[model samples]
Target: MDGRAARETPVHLRLTHRGRVVFGTIGTLLTAGVLALLAALGATSASASAEQSEQSFSTVVAAPGDSLWGIAESLDPEGDPRDLVAELVTLNGMDGSGVQAGESIAVPTRYADAPGVIPAQ
Candidate 1:
């Protein structure tokens, strides 16, 4: 034998049945918690954005020949006029679609300054 002795090799790491089960359960719980947290964050941001972009109102005055249907058509020529008329009535708390000249009416902010749409204030 030489003057130097042989060095001992390190043993490989091993897990028992119980050890494997415990580690697997911990990993699964941690993964589930992370997924849940991400989902919650995503949902919160979506709702916050929706709230921030909510519709707003502006005022317009009725012209001599202007009617609910005309205003609606001017606002969105391609879209249905009835729907917009209903919205106008609802916003201004009108009993019907009738309006007098120079009467101030509330309209959605998006359609406030469109062509033929006169702003009251």
Candidate 2:
């Protein structure tokens, strides 16, 4: 029939149901891929920034009569001495909270030197 022929001609020119579904699926996959890439980049950038902000350390030898509390106070006067001492104990892998005279330990360089005091190399 003439009417049936006209309808069939337009249907053939346009996309079929299967074609539309395939195109939609492809578009969703592409969008998800782009989002995943962006998330990875963002995480990398955050990690880099964290690394940069991390404090650098220098080694210091304990003197006679030096205690962990005193050393922490001298190195980081503005910070809590208890916390600094804990960090020192952890950094040097000391079995206990005790430090021997003339023992070298790693100390965070941030605020380690007071005004007019030269930082150790």
Candidate 3:
């Protein structure tokens, strides 16, 4: 052999017997990892979107002879009755100025009207 060795092909372009097979395997693995990452991101966004569409509220309906004002007054006694009224209206699809007995309404969280709590939009 001469003092200088033969110049071999570059690693990426080499076509040795095992080079092609190994390179193909590595390429496939990298591609799979990238695709998996994309799939995870897509799933996360879809779940978040579904979450935004659905919301839950809690309220109790009044029995016959019970007054709307009384129900409003009694809900979350520690919370702001006004905000409770708003959440109730928004949740039950009731008229802003009207309420009736036997109607279910959502009560705002106790924290909703508590001091130092940020008001809901």
Candidate 4:
């Protein structure tokens, strides 16, 4: 080939041993970082569910003409109904304070035993 043709030809790129080692290490680190992040996310969700499952619930069937205020009061006569009502809403994933007759709802075991009173931990 002429010198001019040789000059125009593309040179193939090559990596030295050190360059290969560096690239390999960088790839491995990125992979490990992604796996670790995923693992942490999984563990967080698992722990949250575990915490929720640890708390036991009691089923209370709604009687005719029953209201959330009434139920909260019945659960704890001496304690504020608002707190219990809020808890019940959260427990049942209710949109509002409405309760239908004969509908079963979950009540925390602790609240059923003693209305408005949480025993010392």
Candidate 5:
């Protein structure tokens, strides 16, 4: 063997211990960052679905003298009752503002136990 061949190291075997440690640490950090980002994305999607499920509708029984306007006012006091009544009409597939007593109807509600609200019979 020539002395020149003995003096020169192969390119594939050029990394030192410190270089290997640095590369390993960098790779670990990159993996951890990617995992954290994926977890955050997953959490956001989960919360979005949870929120969508939370804003669901509720069933209510129409009482005597309970018009769509009155039901809408009781269910969503903070909102425009006319709009809510219109939505109720469309949701129940009603031809007009007429609602019979003891009839089941769907109403938009944010809480399961809403005050002054009658449940579906």
Candidate 6:
């Protein structure tokens, strides 16, 4: 027989105290690293937040040919022009009745912001 064991390295089972200690330490380190990574991600998400934007609006008056429907279509297409009677009534110093020809009013501009908010002279 040669000086080598037959059933040696073929199915080598590391059953020694030192081997078990090394494997346990490796497993503990891996678990600790994964836990730390999860903790860091949680902390980052908790600290994250969103921002808010402030908005303002304005409009022009109606002319001889322009109707409330036309003004609403040009300014606030999402809203009904008839509904805008409230705003128009408030702005152009008009009654709940209606508007006249050659009369200008503030049309709500939802498509974008007022270029420069200012008062009429």
Using TM-score, give the best candidate's number: 4
> For each candidate, what TM-score against the reference?
0.48, 0.46, 0.36, 0.56, 0.46, 0.34
Clashing pairs in 5: none
The sequence of per-residue lDDT tens digits that candidate 5 reaches over residues 32-117 is 99999999999999999789656546687888988888888877789898898888888767899888999887775553467755
Q: How many residue pairs clash in each candidate?
A: 0, 0, 0, 1, 0, 7
lDDT of 2 by residue, 9-96 (tens): 4434678999999999999999999999999999999999778546455677788888889888887778899998998898777887
TM-score of 2: 0.46
What TM-score does candidate 5 get on C-alpha atoms?
A: 0.46
Per-residue CA lDDT of candidate 1, range 29-109, in tens?
999999999999999999997785464456677889889898888788998999989999987779999999999877877
Candidate 4 stretches greater than 4 Å from native: 1-39, 50-56, 114-121
- Give the alpha carbon lDDT tens digit for every residue of 1-121 in model 6: 8657765677656669988999999999999999999999987766662211122335454567766566655555577867766665664556653666756565445433533223233
Candidate achieving higher TM-score, 2 or 3: 2
Off by over 4 Å in 5: 1-57, 109-111, 116-121
Clashing pairs in 1: none
lDDT values for all models: 0.83, 0.78, 0.63, 0.83, 0.80, 0.60
Answer with 1 or 2, whichever has the higher lDDT: 1
lDDT of 4 by residue, 1-121 (tens): 5689767868899999999999999999999999999999999999998899676667677889989899888888889999989999998889999999988778877765554333323
lDDT of 6 at 85: 60
- Residue 64 of model 4, lDDT score: 94
